[model samples]
Target: MTDIELGALLADASQAAAYFVDIHDRAALVEAANALDFTVAAANLAAADDKDALLEQIAEALQFPATFGGNWDALVDSLGDLSWLPAPGYVLLLDHCTDLRDAAPDDFATLLDILDEAASAHARAGVPFWALLPVTSPDA
Candidate 1:
């Protein structure tokens, strides 16, 4: 389990922003969400290896509708339009972000941009959207 506090996470999460939790175990993070005592929209993007794959996985995980176009513009359009979430915020547990980052750095950056922009949009609407990103292992 993450040492991170659920209440604090929720408090920060409530403001509508994207967060990348730095824990390796994505499931533990979900457990933390459970302790949050409220609904949390979650998406597991473990198989997304590239930009298009990532986009499609994200769309499916976040419950994007059938009409969702798998493109940058469509991504931004649909991200802020998640009426099905029904929670204070949304969390994307990306276990393979590091691998994707290594193989497709530019794509990873674009993904970050999209997530940040979406989070900002949700913030404007008083909801939080977080990206729980895991870090590469430390050498120390």
Candidate 2:
């Protein structure tokens, strides 16, 4: 999607949710989020083959507090409450997730569920929280 289109889609809190996009669109996605004053965070999951590594990458990317519990619950909690990263909205880019998705499908599915819940929570509070997964192809 073009930066303008991305910006428009991200501007609406109610419509915010997890989405898969072309890997090449990463830059445009970040630019769009930044243009809308949203906090943009990118987590490189290239080496996150396990749940622990995945959580670690995400915590680091979003700057989770030291108190973060490093678990699925903690992830949902942190994502739902982004007071530390306060902004008009949030955009998280999950980069290079193909390997993880293929290696541990269950973990990836759980992550998506948590992300969806977080997005729903944010939407209810009128804050956009988008999780964008960049894949090499449409089927990825």
Candidate 3:
């Protein structure tokens, strides 16, 4: 989707959800989220072929608190309660995840599940939380 389209979709807290985006549209995605006053954060998973690396990259990207425990529960907790990086909304860009998705499909699926859970939580609280995953192919 175009940035304008993305911005429009992101404006609705109740409709917030995870989405697959064109990898080439990274800049536009960030700009769109920023335009909507969303706290945009990105996790580059290019080098993250395993769950440990995935968690590390996400923690670093989102600037999780020092208390972060570096685990799935910690990720869910942090993503659900992003009080440290407060904003009107949130947009997480998970970039270049194809490798991880291929090398560790289970972990990738779990990550998506956690993200969806967080999105649902935010939606219930009347806040927008979008997770944008950039993939090389439409089928990805």
Index of the highest-lDDT prediction: 2
The TM-scores, one per candidate, come to 0.78, 0.96, 0.93
The parts of candidate 3 lying over 4 Å away from their true place are 1-3
lDDT of 2 at 80: 87
lDDT against the true structure, per candidate, is 0.68, 0.92, 0.88
TM-score order, best first, reads 2, 3, 1
lDDT of each residue in 1-140, candidate 1, tens digit only:
33376546654644545455556555665666666543444445566678788888787777788898899899889877888667766666665566677778898888788888987887777666777676555320
Q: By TM-score, who's the top model here? A: 2
- Report clashes for each candidate as comma-separated counts: 5, 0, 0
Weakest ten-residue segment in model 2 by summed lDDT? 1-10
Ranking by lDDT: 2, 3, 1
lDDT by residue (tens digit), candidate 2, 1-140:
67878898898989998888888888888888999999999999999999999999999999999999999999989998889999999999999998999999999999999999999999998899999999988766
TM-score of predicted structure 2: 0.96
CA error at residue 9 for candidate 3, angstroms:
0.3
List, residue by residue over 4-81, the lDDT tens digit for candidate 3: 787888878878878788777778878888898889988999899999999999999889999999899999999999
Please report the TM-score between candidate 1 and the true structure: 0.78
